[model samples]
Target: MKHFFIEELLPKAGGSVYRLTRMAARRALELSEGRPSLMRKPSSDKVTTIALEEIAEGRIVYNKEASSVSSKDSTSPRAVLMRGNLASSQEKASVS
Candidate 1:
């Protein structure tokens, strides 16, 4: 298989090669451990390739904000626990 070049994947990963590489590795590890893929049409591609494609296609997003959030006090609104799906669900419930 023709592997993806770094250039092709960089922009999708917020133009940070290091971040792309890190997230792709993490995602690839998840795949290797039998995590379900986010893609609709699954190919026989390797885990790493699938991961890079997922990032490129926006199926996965890098969480650069997580680090900053973690550094803040837990009570802060931007804390890690306040930024994920649960927080969004709570917001929706309040707005309804």
Candidate 2:
């Protein structure tokens, strides 16, 4: 399997690790499902390696429309609290 440095691929993924992983993971999923690779010569047979290669080669990119939405500070206290509350509520509802 080929290994890639985060610094090398950051720009290709719009400089966001979140976006990079999102794009790579989706592409990897497609490849694992037997979708033909877009590369003329893929770097590796492993799905993840092929996905990163595609990303580095500009075949895959972060979602432009979602940039604004995903750029939000979802790690803020309020966001975490909201998620925690939602999860607890979901658990409570499911237990009944």
Alpha carbon lDDT of each predicted model: 0.62, 0.64
Best model per TM-score: 2
Candidate 2 per-residue lDDT, tens place, 1-96, comes to 677889989987678897677767766776787777777788678889988887776666554544421112334322111112446789999999
On residues 1-96, what C-alpha lDDT tens digit does candidate 1 reach at each position? Answer: 746778877876668877677767776776787776777665646888887777766667654556221212335332222123557789999999
Q: Tell me the lDDT of model 2 at 89.
A: 83
TM-score of each: 0.60, 0.62
Cα-based RMSD of candidate 1: 13.1
Report the alpha-carbon TM-score of model 2 versus the true structure. 0.62
Residue 91 of candidate 2: its Cα lDDT?
94
> Residue 17 error for model 2, in Å?
0.5
lDDT of 2: 0.64
Cα RMSD, model 2: 10.5
The number of clashing residue pairs in each candidate reads: 0, 0
